[model samples]
Target: MVEQFQNHITPDSQWSTYEANVQSYRGLSMSAQSLYLAVGAILLGLGDKVPFFTVFVLAMVTTWYVFFPVIFARTAVVDFHKFNFGERFSKDGALRTAREDSKLSERAYANVLGGRRLRANVASNIDMPPGQNFRTMRQTRLKLDVFIPASMTVVWCIFAVYFAVFK
Candidate 1:
């Protein structure tokens, strides 16, 4: 069992998979935003030819259809990476090696583990909250992933209502 676990710790093994997922997450996120903008521009260019309600429905549908799947996929990738990293880090020898090699500081290790089960060395000075101090990378990406599509959908809905009632 120990040998099997050690085999996965090599640079080309689990780390590579984590790196690939990070790349995929980035690509999917960028593609979602780009496609959203492109579709919005195309729909907006139609001007008065398209009915407001139709435009709104199309925009909402397109945003949700394109983005929600990407969001789901990214979430899955994140969850997998998180689980994999946590499992690897939990090994006694691995943790000791990481500390001795200065590969990861205590705070960084805690943050990557989502601030859970923090060691004494980490828990003292980094007193923000669980998942709060860990917001270095994921915070902005998650915000953009979820909010942009939702806000755009709301904008379309508002435009549709304004045209229906006022115009």
Candidate 2:
């Protein structure tokens, strides 16, 4: 049993490690957006003097084409997942109209009937061991909201200084 548990720690699973990495990457990607925007804005502010017309155009294109869809799609997917199927598919709802019903996994049905578990399953997959505690893990996790914006502010200030000095 000890060896079996040890194997779970290695990066070999189909879901757990992959999902954990995916979640981490998502957090990092979201955090990078503000920093990218700040850099773009600073570059735009100094574009003419720096003779960086290409960077200016690229930034403009990214702002319109790339930024909106990324943010919107991410928000929509998260919100859609949070919708309750039972409420959304009741007597007055979509499933009733369709004349077909969806089935839930036995475990999932049990979870719903029994009550939703308060603590999230952070293990990403069942093969791996469950984590310590959500509150502790959450507190320790890199909070992108606070630090990402703070770091972006410092970066923007530094870039503004450079733009002024080099101009």
Task: Please give, for residues 1-167, the per-residue lDDT of candidate 1 as tens digits.
Answer: 22235455553365456456556665665565566546545655555435544545655665567545544444443443444434434422133334453332223343333433443233233346666653323666566656766676666666566555655
Cα-based TM-score, every candidate:
0.43, 0.31
TM-score, model 1 to reference: 0.43
Q: What is the Cα-based lDDT of residue 37 in candidate 1?
A: 48
Worst 10 residues of 1 by lDDT: 102-111
In model 2, where is the ten-residue run with the lowest total lDDT?
Answer: 118-127
Candidate 1 backbone clash number:
0
Model 1 superposed RMSD (Cα): 9.0
TM-score of 2: 0.31
Best by lDDT: 1
How many clashes does each candidate structure show, in the order listed? 0, 0
